[model samples]
Target: MMTFDPLGDGISRVEHLDHMGDDLRVVNAARISFDRESHLECDDTGQWLQDQDEKLIGFLAENEHVSPFFHPQICLRITMPSFLAHQWWRSTVGVSRSEVYRRYVVAEPQCYQPPHWRLRAQQPKAGSGTGELGAERQAALSVEVERLYRDIRTLYGQMIQEGVAPELAQAVLPQATYTRWIETGSLHYFVRACGLHTGPMAQRELRLYAEAVSEIVGGLFPVSWKALTRHTAA
Candidate 1:
């Protein structure tokens, strides 16, 4: 499983639940053109098979043959804040997911507490910035955020005690509320997701998630992962 503590809370993780296909699988899928198949365990050719597979992957990437790349599928169990999940779910093409349903289950609320508040960017469209705040101001903001979380949770629990439905009670929760989901998709889709979410100006939280998952993917399929990033970066 792949895991990351993007918020430094260690509460969030992206678990590599299960996956299918690999570098050789992509090569075999493409080799259908020549009515040939690559035997991954066939080391009788020494490094010849490995070298050929890497070259073939590069060729596939260069020529825009994405179908072969789609052969490798990855399934991830992602636990993240609701806001990041919303942005991730927006990259829907070639991706599929199912999320935890709060309508049926009632659980204690968990939240994302940022290490510190980021100041609003001078350019409003730039989002937040690392502008420093006084110790007093920072401490006050931290305390206020924690107080607000407690207040919201208390109200939510009171509603539940009063016989309110979970789905209705959960409406009071903020974007920082933690959520979980299982996402399964092709390698190409993940490459695309990484390309978007891990870019220079991507949301910081989502970028961390993307980078962690890409690390796992790269370790598992080095050659294909390299080919994918090279092609996408082009």
Candidate 2:
């Protein structure tokens, strides 16, 4: 499994979990619509796409004909902030996720430790944060934040050990708490999701994930990924 660390923070990560289908699959999905099928040519040099089929993928992507892209599937294992995961979970089309249930897992889990605080941005778009706090303020805030998280996790563990319902106790954890999930979705879904998440309006933390996903999916479906993301970025 290939894993990426978000911002080099071990607590936040994305693991490439298996993928189904490929660029050939996407090409065939579109070709079958015309009662034709495309195949990869295999030689002593291994398999490669026919030049025309490659061009067809670019045409489909440029024209926004994305249904064929949906024929390929991708799965990923992600561990990120609870708050960030909540925002990601809002994307429901062509995707499903299974998360670690706090109800059954009572062990104390590590929480996210932001490298520093960011000053909120008031321009370009709303809800975006830009830049960082001064070093002095950043260090002070980090100390206080870590103290708060330590105290909260300690109390949560105590409650669970004393017979408190794990479900109810989980509610007391802060948004910075880390959680894990396995998500499965179509190639088109990832392209769309990464495009949106990498935009300036999304949180910086989300960008880390979006970039990681782009890197992984790009390797899996090079032609389609490039064609799709080129148009998406434009």
TM-scores, all candidates, are 0.92, 0.94
The local lDDT score (0 to 100) that residue 77 gets in candidate 1 is: 87
- Each prediction's Cα lDDT score? 0.84, 0.88
lDDT of 1 by residue, 1-234 (tens): 667666678798888888897788899999999999887645555533467778999998878899998888898888999988888887787778998999987888899987776777787755767685778998998899999999999998899999999988999999999999889998888888988887756778888888888987777777888988988751
Q: Name the TM-score of candidate 2.
A: 0.94
Model 2: pairs clashing at backbone N, Cα or C within 3 Å: none
Candidate 1 regions exceeding 4 Å error are 41-49
lDDT of 2 by residue, 1-234 (tens): 888997687667889989999999999999998899988999998998999999999999999998999989999999988989888876788898999999999889788888878887767574656678999999999999999999999999899989999999998899888899999999988988898888768878888898999889989999999899888552
Best by lDDT: 2
Q: Backbone clashes in each candidate structure, one number apiece?
A: 0, 0
Residue 30, candidate 2: alpha-carbon lDDT: 94
